[model samples]
Target: MAVSNVPKYHIAMFPWFAMGHMTPLLHLANEIAKRGHTITYFMPRKAQLKLQHLNLYPDLITFHTITIPHIDGLPPGTEIATEIPISLCPLLVETSDLTQDQIELAFRANKPNFVVHDNAHWMPRLAKQLGIKSICYDVVSAATLALVFVPGRNFPKDRPITEEDLSQLPPGYPSSKVVFRGHEIRPLMMITMPMGKNITFYERMVKAKKDSDAIAIRTCEELEGKLCEYMVAQYKKPVLFTGPVLSAEDMKTPLEDRWDKWLGGLNPGSVVYCSFGSEFILEKDQFEELVFGFEVTGLPFLIALKTPRGCATIEEALPEGFEERVKGRGVVYGGWVQQPLILKHPSVGCFVSHCGASSMWESLMSDCQIVLVPQLIDQVLNTRQLAEELEVAVEVKREENGWFTKESLSNAIKSVMDSDSEVGVKVKNNHAKWKEILGKPEFMSGYADRFVQNLHDLVK
Candidate 1:
C-alpha cells in the first residue's frame, strides 16, 4: 500500500455480463494484479455477487460496480448477470451513452491508463470519450472471428449466411465435422457470412476490427495458426493471441473425502455430468430428445435442466418414467453445477456441452472427451471448428434446433467411449496437448506477464 510500492500501470476491464466473459477477465485481472498493476473490473453488481458466489480471489483485484438502468423492454427481474438475447443486446448499446458516462466517471476518479473492453460493449466510442487507449477483448478464438466475418466469393450479395453452408468447410479449412448426431446438418451456417451482415453483433465486430487500438483474442498460435492469420489480415490491428485465461484452482478437487462420500456406491465413470451453462434452457421437444438420449445412452446421467418454458424445473422437465427407467443412475439438479470439478472427476469421461469458450476450455483442460451440443449464436460455429478444425471434440448434432434423437445420443457416447477409434485417439491427444499447454504453472505465468506488459504499453 506504500506510495512507491504501489508500482505503476493501472488498467480497467469491462466484459460482457456472462460467466464466460467474466471468468477470463477476472483471471487476467488477477494476473495483472500479481504483476504489481492495479485492475478495477467494471461490471454490474450482480456479476460481483456471482464472482463472490464462486469464491473467487477477491483480494487480488478490485470491483467497480456499474448499476445497469432498468430498461423497459427487458423482461421483468432479468438480472444483468443473466443472458440477454441478441435482439435485446442492442438496447445495451443504445444505452451505451449512459453506461459510458458511468464508466467515464469511474475513469475520472481512478484514471486508468488503459481499458480492456468486451467485443459487445460500445468500447471504441467509450474509450474515445475518455481519451484512454482501448483494447477489444475477444472471449472466443480469432479463427472464429475471421471465419465468421471474412467474406467468401460464395457469400450472398445481402444477408447473414445466405444459404445453408454448414457442411461447407472454410477455405483450406482444417478437418471439421461433416456430420453430427445421425445425418443432421447445420442449417444456420447456410445463411450469409457472419461478418458482412449488418446485424448488431456484426456491426460491433466490424467497428472493433476497424477502430480498436488493438485486439486481444483468447487463443494461442500453437492451437490455431491459420485462424490467427486470418484475423490479423482481416482486422488490420495488432492481434494479441493471449493464451486461454484460466485459473488453476478452477479445478478445485471437491474435497477428496467429500467426493468419495458422495459417490460411495456408484461405479467409477457411472455419473454423466450435464450442464447447459447458466443460460440456455431446452424447449419441450428438445427436452424430450434429451430425456430419451439419456435413457438410450444407457449411462447413469445427471441432468441440470433450465428453460424459459416451464420445463426448467426437474419434475416438470423429466418425461414420465424417466426417473423410473434410469432409477439410481439418474440425478437431476435444477440449477448450475460445479463444472470444473465435475469435468475433472474420474467418473467424468465425457462432457455434453454447448461449446461456449469457457466450457470448451474447461472440458479440454480437464482432459475429457467432449460431445458438443451448441444451442444458439456462435456456438454452432464454435462446435464445428472444435470438432472439424481441432479434431479433439465431437459434435452432438448439426441442427441448430439442438434436436438429437435418442439413438444418436447413444451412438455419440458410444463413439466417444470406443477407446480404439481414430477420433477418440485424436481427442485424447488434443486433450493431452491442452493439459500440457495450460497445466504448466510457468507458462500460465508467462501469459499473465505478457498480458500485463501489453496493457502497460497500450497506456504508455
Candidate 2:
C-alpha cells in the first residue's frame, strides 16, 4: 500500500460507448490515477465531452479521442448508444469497430502496460496482437453476467429466447435460483447484430472472457458474494471486485441550482425522485401510467425524463393538464438533472428508478429507499438483486402477463414511503445500512487498491 512500493503502470482504458459504461470507467480511471499510474482514456470525441464537468487528474490521466466512423442507418451526429434508439445499437457497435485501427495506432504510440475494456468484444484480440495484457471490465451486476455466461444460453445466435427459457434457472449457476420472465429477457434479445456475422452478443461476451487475462467487475463481495465466487470458478480466472465506486462528491448539493432550491423548501424525507435513465425511451402509454401513478401518491416529487429523439417537447409527450394538477407538489424536467445531488438531498425519501447499475449504486449510497421499475437490459436482473436478494427495495407488481398498471405503481411507491408499513421501515433501514457501508472512504479505497494490485499481478 506504500506509494513508493506500488508499481506505477501505464494503463489504457476503453469502455463501450454508453454513459453507463463510460461513467464507471471514469471512476476506475480516477482511482488508478490516484495510485500514480498513468492512464490513457480512449473514447469518441462527443463521448469525451461528458467528462468535462468532472475533476480528473491532469498529470496522470489523458483523454484520447477516436473519430467515429460513419455507418448507414445511424444518425449522423450520434456518438453514444443512449443518443439513439435501442434498435440502432448494433449499428453503433459496427461503427465503433471501425475505430480499431485508430485505437491500435494510439496503443502502439503509448505502449500501455495493459488495457481495460468493457463489452467491446474485439479488444482482447487487439491487445494480444499488441503484446499487452487485456482486462475485461463489466459494469453490470454479477447475476446478469452469470446468466449471460450460463452454459447453452445460445443467446443471440439461436432463436429468440422464449418465456420458458427465462422461467428456468440458468444451468450451472451457484445456489441462487434466479429466474427471468419473458418481459425481462425481451429487451436483451432485441440487441442483436445482423445474422450472418457469426458473432452474437453472447459470443462476444464469451470471447472477451476467453481471451482476457482477468476480469474486473463493478460490485462488492458484500453485495454479490455468491455470484462473484461462481464467476471466478466458472471462468477459472482472477476476478476482482471494484466495489461500488460511489463518489463522495455525490453527497454534495450544488448551490443555487433550481432543483436544489426546490428541494430545500420541502420537509426532510418528504419527496420522491423518479427517473428512468437516459437509454430507456418510454412509450406514450407507459409515460402516462407513471405520471398517473405519481399523481395518486400525492407526495412531493421530481421526475426527470429525456425527450425521445424527434419528440419536440416534454409537454407534447405528457398527458394534458398533468403539470397543472400537481403544480405545487410536482415538477418535471425535459432533460438531464444532477441525479446524485437530488438523491442525496434530505427531502428525497424514495427513488423510483429504472434499476440501471449506475442509478442503483447512487441510490444505495444515498438515504433514499428504492422502488424498482426496470426498463431495459440487465436492469431487471439488478431489480432482482435489490428487491429479492438484498430486501432493500419493493418491485411494482405486474399482472401474470407482465403488465404493470398505474394502481400497481402507486401501491409500490406507497409500500416503500408509508411510515406505518413494516415493509417500508425495513426497506428504509436496509438502504441506510448499505449507504453507511458504501459511503466509507476506507472501504471504497481498499477495493480500488485491490483492483490495481490485481492488474499489476496480471501484467507481471
Candidate 3:
C-alpha cells in the first residue's frame, strides 16, 4: 500500500463467536477496507480458520485470533457456539466475557480510532476508557430489532413475561405483520433471563446500544426506512446502514464438482434446495416430516441439515423405505456445503430456507423463488420482512403446535414452483425486482462508502 493511498483510519471489530454473527461483521469489514481504511478483526481462532477466505483485502484488513477460555462444563476445545447444544450457549457467553482483559490489550496495541462490535457491550465502556469511539453493529434484521429489542420494550419486572407478552407488538413498533405465534415465542422468553454472572441477553444489547457512540446494521433505508427511523428515535443516537454487505464478485471459488455435476443434470429452475444455516438441529418428527414433504413435492431436491435427535447421521434418521423412493431425485445431506454458490446454481430455482438474515439477502439476490420456515426469533422476523412486507417470499404455514405438516411444506413449494399458481407469479415478480436493485454494484458500494464517511466524521 502506498502512502498516498494509506488507510484513512484504523478500526477494530469483534462480533459474537457464532459464525452467524462473525461472518456478517467480516463482510462489513471487507466493504470498509475497500475504501482504503485499515481493520483489525478479532474472532475465535477456529472462526478465523473457517472464514479467512472472506478476508478479500488482506493488505488492508488483518485477523487477530482469539481462543475461548476453558470453562468447567465445556469440552476441552469448545471455541464456538455452533459446536454445542443451544442450552450450552450461555457458557460460551460467559467464556467470551472473560476476555475483557485480552481485548483491552489488543486495543492498547492496535490503537483503533473506532471499536465496532456486537454482544460485547463492554466494548463501548472499554473504548471510552481508551479514547476510541464505539460502534454497535447488528447483523440481525432491522425489523427484528425494532419489533423485539427496542428500548422500552421489556416487560414489567413485577411479573414474568408470558408468551402473550412476547406475541404483542412493542409500543410504536414499526410493524404488526411480524408477530410471533404459538410455541414460536418460546425462544424470545429467554431474552431477559440471566446467563453468565447474571448478565442477561437483553441487558447486554441495551448497554451495547445505549453506550455506543452510534449504531449500525447491514440494511439500508430503501428496504427498511421506517425501522431505521424507529431505531434512531428509540436509541436517540446516530444510526447507519451498509446495504446488505455481500458481493458475488468477492466469492471466486466455484461450486465443488460433485454438487455441480448433480445440480447440472437437472432442468433449469426445477430443483428445490433447502438449508437452515448453521446451528439448527431439527427434532426427530419434524426432520422426518420435512424430508417426507420434499418427497411429496416430487421435485428434484437437496436438503442440507443436521441429523435429528437420537440419530448419528442423516442416513440413520431416514424413515423406512425413504431411500428407495427418492434415491435418484432427492438428497438428504447432513454436512456443510457452499450455500451461496449453491443458491446461485442455475438448476436451483426454488430455495426453502430458515429465513436467516444472510440467507434472506442471498435468496433475494438470486433468481430463485423463496420459501421460508423460520425457527428462531430473528428468523421469524426476517420471514415477515420478505413474505409480508416485501411480498417476495412465502412462509410455510405451520400448525398451532408450531410444526408444519408435510402437506403444508409440499404445498408451499408447489405454490411457488407451479407457473400457473397466483402466489408463485407474485413472489417471482417481486423477487426479480429486488434482485435487480441489490445486484447493482453502485447501490451496494455507495452505502459502504457513506458508512465509512460517517465514521470518519465521528472522529474528525
Candidate 4:
C-alpha cells in the first residue's frame, strides 16, 4: 500500500502519569512527529519533568498541562493523570475525573485526525461527541490484556491456583501457565499499592471498554501472538501490538562502562539490582522485610528506596545495624535510577523486581536474571509464569500478610547469585535467548511502522 499524501495531522497523545505509560507513549509521539504529525502531548507537571529529563522538550512536542478548577482535597499542581495512585482503582477514578474536561476541549479545538489516549484516560467517551477518532492504548503486556478481556472459564476455585486453573490458557499458547484477558483480571484482584482499595473504579472500566473506537496495547503479536488473538476475539476491536517503543538512540549513560566499574570493585555476577518501578509505596512492615532480606542475603546490591519522608518508618523496619553493616557493599539511592542501564550492566547478575511489563521486558532484553517480587494485579500471575512455568526467573515466597519476609528475599537473592545453582544457570541461559529475540531490528521498528499504518488507515 502506498503512503497517503494527505496534509499533516494534529494529534493528541495522552498517557497516564506513571513512568511505564509515559515512556512508551512518548516514543509513539516521536514516531508520529517523524511522520510530520504535530503532537500535543497532554500530561501533568511532574510527568512533564520526567519527559523533559528524557530530552522530550516542548519545542519538540506541544505539552498541554491539565488545570483543575475549584478542586478541593487536591494538593496544588495535582493533575489527575500524573497524581493518581499506582493501583488501577484510584487511577481509573482520578483519570476519569481529571481528563474528561481537557479531553472534550482538546478534541474540539484540535479536531485531531485521531486522539491517541491511554486506556486509563478519558478520551474514549468524548471522541464521538467531539467528532474525532480515539483509540485505547494499553501500556501493559498483550498477554496481560488477553487475560483481562477474555473471561476465565469456570474453574474450581477450591485452591488459590490449581493445575486445572493453569490449563485454561488461551488456545495456541502453551497451557502450562494460566493467562486471562487483561480487562477481566483487574476487577477480581485485591487492588492495593500506591493507594488502597476502591471497588467502584472497576465498574467504570467496564463502561469505558464499551465506549472506545479501538484499542491498542504496548506489545507485539510476534512476542505474544496467541494472547493478542484472544484480546481481539473478546474486545471486538482492532488490538495492535506495537512492540516496545524504546528508542535505542543514546537513552542515557552507557551501561557497559558503569558495569565494568561496578565489577572491578566486586566479584563477577555479585551485584543484585532491586527496583519496584515508581508505583509501589511500601508499608512499614513490607519495607522492613525487604531491608532485612537484603541484610540476610549477604550480597552486594543496588536498591532504589523511594519511601516518602513519613514512610521513613523503614528505619524501624530494618534489623539493628543493617545500614552500617552493609556500608559501601550495598548501595541504596532514593528516587529513580536508569533501570535498563542497571539491568544491562555486567556487574548486576540478578533483578528483584515488581514485574511491571516494561521492567520485565527490559530485564529479558538485557539478559538479566530475575527474582520476582510481585505486589499486585497481574504481577503475581506474571511471576508464576516467569518463574514456575518458563524457568527463566525465581519467585520470592510470600507470607500471609501479603509481604515476602527478609528470609525469603535473602534466600532468593543468594540462590540467583550462586554460580553452582542449576536454577541460576538456567535463568542466565534463557535470558541470553530472550535478548537475542528482542534485539532483532525488525522486532522494534518494523512492527511499529505497521501499527502506525494501521492507525493511519482508520483515520484516512
Candidate 5:
C-alpha cells in the first residue's frame, strides 16, 4: 500500500467471549484494516480458533489470545461462554474480569491510539489507566442498549428485576414502550441479572457506558433511527452507527458441498432455512415439536441445530423415524454450516431464526422473509422490532402462558412461505426494499468511514 495523506491508527479490540460477539468485532476490525489501520484483536484461545476460516488481512490484523483463568464452578475445558449453560454466564463474566491484568500488560508493552471493548465493565477503566481513549462497541440492537444504558431507566441497583418491572416501560424512555412478554423477559433477566454476583449485568453495562469516551453500535439509522436518536439524547455521547458490516467473503462456502448442492437443486423461494444459533439448547420435547412442525409444512427445508449437552448425536435428540418421515424434503445438520451462504441461496425464501441481530441483518441482505422463534436474551426484543415495527417478519404465536405448539410453528412457517398470502407478500416486499439498501457499497461503507473519522478526532 502506498503512503497517503490519511492518518493511520493502531486500535485494539476486546469483545465478550462468544461467537455472536466475536464475529461482529472481527468484521469491524476487517473494515478498519481496509482503511490502512492496524488492529490487535484480543480473544480467548478457543474463540480465536473459530476465526481460522475467515480471510482476514494478515498484515493489518493480529490475533492475541488471552488465557482464560478457570473458575471453580465452571466446567473444565469450557473456555468460551457458549460451551456452557446460560445459568453459568455470571461465572463467565467473572472469569473475563480475571484477564484484566493480562490485558493491561499487553497494553503497556504496545500502546495504541484507542481501545474498543464490548459489554465487559472493566475495559473502560483499564483503558483510562493507560491514557487511551475507550469506545464501547455494542453488538445488540440500539433499542436494547437504550433501555439498559440510559440513566435512571435501568433496573433498581439494589434489587433484581421482577416480572412487574419487565412489563413496564423503562424509566426516562416514556416514548419507548415495553414490547416483551413476561415469559420472554424471564430468561433474559436470568442471564443478565444472575444471582450471587457482586455486579449485575445491568450495572456492568452502566459502567461501560459511563466510562467510555464514545459508543459504536452495529446497526444503521434506517432500521433503528428513532431509538438511535433517543440514545444520543439520553447518553450525551458521540454515538456512531456502523451499518451491518457484511461482506461476501464472510459468506463464502464451497458450492460443491452437500448442503450447497441440495439447496441449489431446490426451486427458488421454496425452502425454509432454520437455525437457532450456537448458544440456545432446546429441550427434547421442544425440539421434537419444532421438527414435527417443519415436517407438517411439507416444504423443502434445511435446519441446523446445536447438539444438546450429553447428546451424542442429533439422532439421539430427534423423534423416532422423524428423519425418515421427512426424507427427501428436509435435511437436519447437527453442527455448524455456512449460514450466510444458505440464506443467500435462491431456494431459500424464508429464514426460521432465533431473531438474533446478526441473523436479522443476514436475512435482510439476502432478501429472505423471516419467521421468528426467539429463544433467549435480546432475541425477543429483536423479534418485536421485526414483527411489530418493521413488519418484515411473522412471529409464531405461542400459548397464553407462552408455551409453543407444533401447530403454531407450522402456521408461522406457512404464513411466511405462502407467496399468495397477504402477510407473505408484504414480508417479501419489505425484505426486498432493505436488501436494495444493504446492497449499496456507499451506504454501508459510509458508516464505517464516519466511525473511523470520529475515532481519529477522539484520539487527537
Candidate 6:
C-alpha cells in the first residue's frame, strides 16, 4: 500500500500509575509512533514528567497530564507509585480512579481509535461506553500471568488465599514447572486482599482482562508462546505480544564514567553485581544477609538497593566492621545504577537479581551468569521460568520461613560463578545461547510489527 493508503491510527493509553507499568507502556508507545501512528498518553503530572525523556517520537506521541485527586490517606500531591511507600498504593489507586471523569472527557474530545489500559478494571467498560476498543496490557512476565493469577483460581469455600493454597497449581495452568514455593507466595496471596472498599485485587484483574476487547502482553511469542496461548484459552480472548519492549534509549545510553572506570580496573568476568528493583525496601536483617552473602563470595561486588527498614542508610545497616573488611572490593550504594550498562560490563560475570519482569529480560540478554533471589510473586514465577523452564538461571533457596541465609545466597552465586561447577558451565552456555537469539534486531522488531497489526485488526 502507498503511504496515503495506509490507515493511520490515533491510540490513547492510560497505564496504571506505577513506574513499572508506565515505563513499558511508554516503550510500546514509542514503537507505535515509530510506524506513524499518533498516541495520546494520559498520566499524572509527575509521571508525565518522568517519562518525557523516554518519548522518542515526540512529534507522534503527545502526553496529556491529568490531576491526581486528593484521597484521605495519600499524602498531598502524591501522583505516582514512587512518591509513596508500597503500602499506600491502594490509596494512590483510589486517588487515580478519581481522574476517570477527566480521562473520559479526553477520550470524548480526542476520539482516539483505540484505548489501552491495565489494572483500572473500570477502563474496559468505560471504553465501551465511549465507543473505543480497549486492550488490557500485561507488562509483567507471561508466566506470572499464566500460572498464578489466572482468573477463577479456586479457594476452598470462601476462605482466604494462603501459602498452602498457592503451593498447589490451578487447573488447566499451562506449566507445572513454574510453581511457587512457600516463602514466595506473599505477592500472589495479596491478590485476595482488598485494593478498594468494593474490590479485591484479583477481582480487579479478572474484570480488566475479561472485559477488554483484546489482551496484550509485553513478551515475545517465541519466548513465552505457551504462556500467552494459555492466557487466550483462560480468558477466551485474542492475546497480542509486544516482545520485551526494552528502551532503545537505554541501549544507546552509555554507562557513566563513575562506574566504567571502577569496573574496568577489575579482571574480566570476576565481579558479582546484585540489585533488586527500586520498590522493595528490605528488612535490616535480610539486608545484612544479602551484603554478607556477597562479601563471603570473596569476589568484587556492587549492590544497589534502597535503604532497608529501620536503618537510615546502607552504611548504618552494615554488619560490624564489615566496610573495613571488604573496603576496596565491595560497595553498597542506595542510589540508582544503570542496570543494563552494569550488566554489559566485562568484570560483571554474575547477576543476582530479584527477577522483576524488566530485569529478567535485561539479564537474559546480557552475558552475565544469571542468579535469582525472588521476593515478590511475579519475580518468583519469573525465576522459575528462567531457572526451570528455560534452564538459564539459578534461584537461591529460601528457608522454611521464606528467608535466605548468607550461606544459601553465597552458594547460589558461587554455583554459577565457578567454572569447575557443572551448574555454572550449564547456565553460562544457556544464557549465551538465549542472549544471541533475543538480542537479534529482527526477532525483537517482529513482535512489535505483529502487535500493531493486531491493534488494527481489533479496531476494524
Best by lDDT: 3
lDDT of 3 by residue, 1-460 (tens): 3323444889999888888888888888888887788999988898988998888899999999876899998888989888987778888888988888889999998899998988577889999999999999998988878877777775656655666877777768777777665455567656777667677778878778999999998888889889989989999998898788875554588899999999999999999999998988889999999999999999999999977888998999999999999988999999989888998899999999998889999999899999999988888888988998889999999998888999999999999999999999999999999888888868887887788878877866
* Clash list (residue pairs), candidate 3: none
- List candidate 2 segments past 4 Å from native: 1-4, 155-158, 175-177, 182-185, 191-197, 252-256, 308-310
Candidate lDDT values, in order: 0.67, 0.81, 0.87, 0.65, 0.80, 0.86
Q: Each candidate's TM vs. the true structure?
A: 0.85, 0.95, 0.96, 0.83, 0.94, 0.96
True-structure RMSD, every candidate: 4.5, 2.0, 2.3, 4.8, 2.4, 1.8
Which of the predicted structures, 2 or 4, would earn the higher TM-score when compared with the native?
Answer: 2
**CA lDDT, candidate 1, residue 85:** 49
Q: In candidate 6, residue 147 scores what lDDT?
A: 71
Give candidate 4's total backbone clashes.
Answer: 14
TM-score of 2: 0.95
TM-score of 3: 0.96
Per-residue lDDT over 1-460 for candidate 2, one digit per residue giving the tens place of the 0 to 100 score = 5534678899999888988898888888888888889999998888888875553687888999889887788889878988888888777878877888998999999999899998667888999998989999999888888876543564434576665655566656764635465364457575344511456676677678767888888999888888888888878898889988765654554634788789899999999999988788877777778888999898999999876445678778778898899998998778788888888788999999989999988878778879988876588888888888778899898766455888999999999888999999998888778878777768989998888878767755
Q: Please tell me which model should have the higher TM-score, number 2 or number 3.
A: 3
Better of 1 and 4 by lDDT: 1
lDDT tens digits by residue: candidate 1, 329-426: 76666756667776766776778888888887777677677787776545666776678766778776434444777777767766776778787777
Residue by residue across 1-460, what tens digits does model 6's lDDT show? 3333448899999998888889999999998888889999999889887889999999999999998888798888889887777888878877777888999999999999888897678898899998899999988888878876678777553665666777777767778888776564456556777676578777777888999999898888778898888888999989999899887688688898889998998999999999888688888989999999999999999999999999887889999999999988898999889898899899999999999988998898899999998888888888988999889999998898788999999999999989999999988888888889998878877877778888877866
**Residue 260 C-alpha lDDT in model 1:** 45
Q: Is candidate 2 or candidate 5 better by lDDT?
A: 2
What alpha-carbon RMSD in Å does predicted model 4 have with respect to the real structure?
Answer: 4.8
Error of 6 at 5 (Å): 6.2
